[model samples]
Structure formats: structure tokens, C-alpha cells
Target: AKTSGGFAPFSHTVTSVTHHKGSSTVRALSMISSQSTSAEISWGIPTGSEGRKLRYIISYKCVNQLACSPGCQDAVEGRLTQENTRMTLSPLLPFTQYLVTVTPEDGLPSEIYVGTSEAVPTEIPSLSFRSPDRTNTSLTVYWEPTIVCSS
Candidate 1:
């Protein structure tokens, strides 16, 4: 305290502090089950950014297709929380390669490549007798279905 003659002047100084959190990122993504027309996937929760809730959006695209129409580019969205990080993507093309993306609300997205299982043929051709065309060493049989890899 300073006094001028008989009076004193008082003053105070205040300091401000701020805290910044670290950036977050996706940890891992694994395939739970992948079928001909549907797929289930799960991922690990990210770290470093605490107390901040994030939403996860899942999307996929076919590797062979030119467009994202059939691969759920914008259709499948997963709002997964910290504990729940699993989702199922369906109505996909069979026997096709897909690039799956898991985008978090805080940081950059993580990607994984997955392939669907082959579909079974719906049509079955009847067996025909061709004994006259069989050779001494081998026999020839023919059964045809046009949709080999329709997707």
C-alpha cells in the first residue's frame, strides 16, 4: 500500500488461464461378420479428448463401382457413442470390395477395406444324360448360370 500525503490508493491485477485439449483420432476398425448382402462392423473408441462426446458416422463405397449408389455412401449413418461402437451395413452388393469409412465428430476419419461373401446361385439346372458323348478317360457335364458376379 502506497500513501500520498494522508490518502492511499489500492489496485489489483488479475491473471487469466486457459486449457486446451488434445486432438482425438480413431483407434481401430474390425469386421464382426460379413455376408453376401450385409455386413457388421465394430471399432475401437478414440482417446486423448476427454469429456467430449462424439458421434460416429459410417459409410461405404464399392471398389468396382463408379458411383456410390449401391454401397451406402450417404444412406448408412452410425451415431455411435464411446461404449457402443458397432454398426451393421446392409443391402450391399455381393462378392464385391468395399471401402468402409468411420468418421468421428471430432477428428479425421478412418478407413478399412472389406469384401462381401459370394452369393449362392438361385437357379439349379436339371441333370441330363449324355452317356454317348462320354469318353473312355473322362466325362463332360455342363451347367450354366449367367450371374457369376452380378454385383
Candidate 2:
């Protein structure tokens, strides 16, 4: 406090504080299982990075014509401990391409990892054809469905 010769002149000085955001760091994503109509995804957080009540959001889209359809979004909530972080997307189209990304709460919008899902086909039948006469101009075709066919 400061006082003048007459009475007193008082003044106060106040200090203000502000906070800024920190740098962005995200965990890596892993593909657990990929099926004809479904994909299982997983990821992990850094050591000592877990905070209170953390949540995850998984975003995905058809990246290739094989499974290309439209973009889809899903989310997982809870804290992760000894168990591996996992999630599965099912009922997808056969032989399609998909892109998936995982994002955590309090994480930067751009600090996320993107991964691709495997292309699996439901068709498992194989066809075989042979002609009776190799030298004959006329030919007949026959097909037998085999159980071991992959695309």
C-alpha cells in the first residue's frame, strides 16, 4: 500500500494467469481380425498416459472399391488396464476395402492413427472345366464347385 502526504492514495496491482495446450501424441492402431463382413480393431495407450475416465472413438470408411460404400463411425468407452484395447465392426460387404482410425479423449483432432482392414470374400467355391476331346473343334464345358476357393 502507498500513501500520499494528504490522507492516502492507494493502488493495487493484479496478476493474471493463462494456460495453453500441450503437444499432441497418439497411440498406434492394430488390426486384430478381418472377415468378409467384419473387422476387429485394437490399440494401446502410452505408459503412464492413462487419465481419469478416458474414452475412445473409432472412425472408419470404405477406402477401396472392394468394400467401398460409405463412411461409418463408432466409439468405445472405459479405462484400459491389462487387457488389450479392442473393438469389432461386423456385417460389412465382401471383398471390400476399409479405413479405420482411433481417437482418444483430450487428444488432438489431428493426432490420430489410421489403418486399413483386410479384404475378405464370402465366396469359397472353386470351378474346374475340361474338354473330353483335346483335338476336336467342338468343346463342352463342365464345372465342379470346390470348397477351397479364395479371392
Candidate 3:
């Protein structure tokens, strides 16, 4: 009924509204962080709506209890179009756990759906140096893999 942001302000009345069934699907989830901070988030739009207007919201929390609750200090809310929607959350602390929720707006009230994702670990690989002779002319280096295995 009420619209915000750069869009025009208006309200519409409907006879009846139906809440979407099942859970919201997260098409893509990622973390955007700097040298010492991280932000965990996901992006996707409600499916099976068949062109119905929708609204999406995402919430998150850090793994380290001392760090902060609601890892993402800011809240992102926006209108959904017919095409797939993508939502990028605010910056968060490094190596944290985040919970996100998405909801669609119908004529009545919006329904809530939730999901969770963890931030990728940030650990630098250790390097080793080797040389055939005392001279530094030709040296060989070995390092561990930068990626982590899930199993």
C-alpha cells in the first residue's frame, strides 16, 4: 500500500491478497569485505508469483558473540519486479555467521521466509622457500592451497 525510496508515492486497495507458499529461494550468496571486515548476504527474488509485486528484506548476525548481533548494521528493503531480484547486504565483520530473511508484499501483509549463510574464512597461505645454493639467484617456493575443503 505504501511505497518508499525514489519511486513515486502511492497506495492501492485490493479485495483480497494471498500469501506465497513454501520458502524463499536464494539464488546467489556471497560475502563482500575489505582487509578486516566482511559482509555475508544472498540475492534472489520470490518465484511462482506470476508478476505479483514483492518486497524483500535480509537480516544477519556474526558468529563471534562478542562481535555483534545483527552483523549487518543496516537493513535493505526494496520493491521486486517481474525479473529476478538481487540484494547485497551491508558490510560485516570477518569470519562470521549470518541469517537472512526474504518476504513478498501482497495486498494484505507480507509473509516472512528465512535463510542462513556463513562468511568465508580469511586465512593467508603459508609460504616456504628453497634454494639449491647459498646464492639467491634461483629459488623455489611452495605454498598451501588457499581454498578450504568442505568434507
Best by lDDT: 1
Q: Order the candidates by TM-score, highest first.
A: 1, 2, 3
How many clashes in each structure? Answer: 0, 4, 2
Give Cα-based local distance difference scores for all models.
Answer: 0.66, 0.49, 0.42
Best prediction by TM-score: 1
The list of candidate 1 runs beyond 4 A from truth reads 1-23, 65-83, 122-147
- Model 1 accuracy (lDDT, Cα): 0.66
Candidate 2 vs 3: which has more TM-score: 2
Model 3 stretches astray by more than 4 angstroms: 1-36, 65-84, 106-151
Error of 2 at 150 (Å): 14
Residue 75 of model 3 has an lDDT of 32
Model 3 scores worst on lDDT over the 10 consecutive residues at: 107-116
Please give, for residues 88-151, the per-residue lDDT of candidate 3 as tens digits.
4445444333444444344222323332334445557776554334455775567766643110
lDDT tens digits, residues 1-151, model 1? 6576765676787899875543455787888999887788888767865565667777787675312345433332233333357887777766667788887765678888877787764545655554335788987786543423343
lDDT score of residue 120 within candidate 2: 43
Rank candidates, lDDT, best first: 1, 2, 3
